[model samples]
Target: MGYAQVNGVRLYYEVSGSGRPLVLLHGGFGSTESFAALRPALLARRRLVAVDLPGHGRTADADRPLRYETMADDVAALVGQLDLGETDLLGYSLGGAVALRLAIQHPRLLRRLVLVSTPFRRRGWYPAVLAAMAAQDERTGERMRGTPAHETYARIAPRPQDWPRLWARSGELMRREYDWSAEVAALTVPTLLVFADADSIPVGHAAEFFGLLGGGHRDGGWDGADRPASRLAVLPGLTHYDILDAPALPAAVLPFLTHPVREPT
Candidate 1:
């Protein structure tokens, strides 16, 4: 457990276990500790490098605005600094956005990727989810006071007083709009999109995103030959907030990351 100076932020990350490295990036308002439920399974299989993004977790915020592209660059810098060749990456929610950006901006850096409850486009989130997006402002931070995410931030953050700034900035970042449909279709890295059956994004968008990755388009022959390198997983009876903690999450994810996908010659 140490810090890597990446893109002007003292990025805090931890490495554990043995075997192929799998970098874990958490969702918004969360830190490396967010993976507590899923950690054992992931650590048992791969070298886990769980990191706290710029503002969340143990890492302190930089003077720059919170943006996925820069956050992705921070992760890229960390990966390069560690010299983790062809590593696997997994990100949830906000982390997923950063991971997706990293995969797009630096495809050669990843062998495989697992995106948990993430969307390629801002509209991918449900309308109600977008409603909550617009609802954020200065007062929004106080509204989050005493909540679990806020409480967690208050405990581990380098500057606990940054809680309000964190919330306001998170809202600002979430409010920014961009779409990567064309870029996603051009992505070469294998990815697994994991979404809860009852997620913040409409279930149909999952299929749409999967399709962009060249999945859900064709049938495998009798020998199961027509499958795409990328895959999709929808865990039952779970929502966006709880999907990462579900036992079935690793069940659906690990195999895709651990084994080789059969790419046709």
Candidate 2:
């Protein structure tokens, strides 16, 4: 376990292995432990840096509401603190949004990027669900359960006292919005997009995200030919949460992380 202070917030992180740096960003309502199952395989060939974003895990609560851009800045600050000028980035769900923000705001800080189960647009249903959960938290003062985000909270943040803050942070992120499509299109770093076949965020939306990139047109789908160096892989039979436990996910991703990106023909 290690720690870095970014923007007056104490961020908890862990480092393992020794090679090119690879930073892992867990989704909203999740902590650094979200990557526990995948870290070993990743660490075998790269130095892994997994962090507890503000208001999650062992990190302290934020003074203000959580926003993707602010979270991105926090990540950039951590990169600078470690002196890892240009490193590979892997983010899951909401964390992926943060990763996208980082690529937009500080492109030079990242060499490669990987996003899993991320949504490009804020859905209409999200805010109501988040608000209901926050209201429940405030009324009963008991943490909610059964949701994918809640499951992550249960696993990563076991302490009872930490629940409300995590819940609040999760709500804050859900309510915040950003225009990531245009920003993503401007990115130059090699990127890999992965989503579960049955993910709540439609696979077609992921396809749209891939199209918005510099190398491809939104009209044409990913045909493999004329595909950008950036690629998208939909893991079959997996849902929003299943990707976390999928047995074959690491194998599917490892190759892409190590394989050098080819220039568009």
Candidate closest to the true structure, highest lDDT: 1
Clashes of each: 0, 0
Best candidate, TM-score: 1
Q: In model 1, what is the error at residue 89, expressed in angstroms?
A: 0.4
Per-residue error (Å), model 2, residue 196: 0.3
In candidate 2 the C-alpha lDDT for residue 198 amounts to: 79
- Candidate 2, residue 68: the lDDT equals 83
Model 1: residue 77 alpha-carbon error in angstroms? 0.4
- Against the hidden reference, what TM-scores do the models get? 0.98, 0.85
C-alpha positional error of residue 91 in candidate 2 after TM-score superposition, expressed in Å = 0.3
lDDT of each: 0.92, 0.76
lDDT of 2 by residue, 181-239 (tens): 67777777878888888776776778788777644464334654445778788899888
TM-score of 1: 0.98
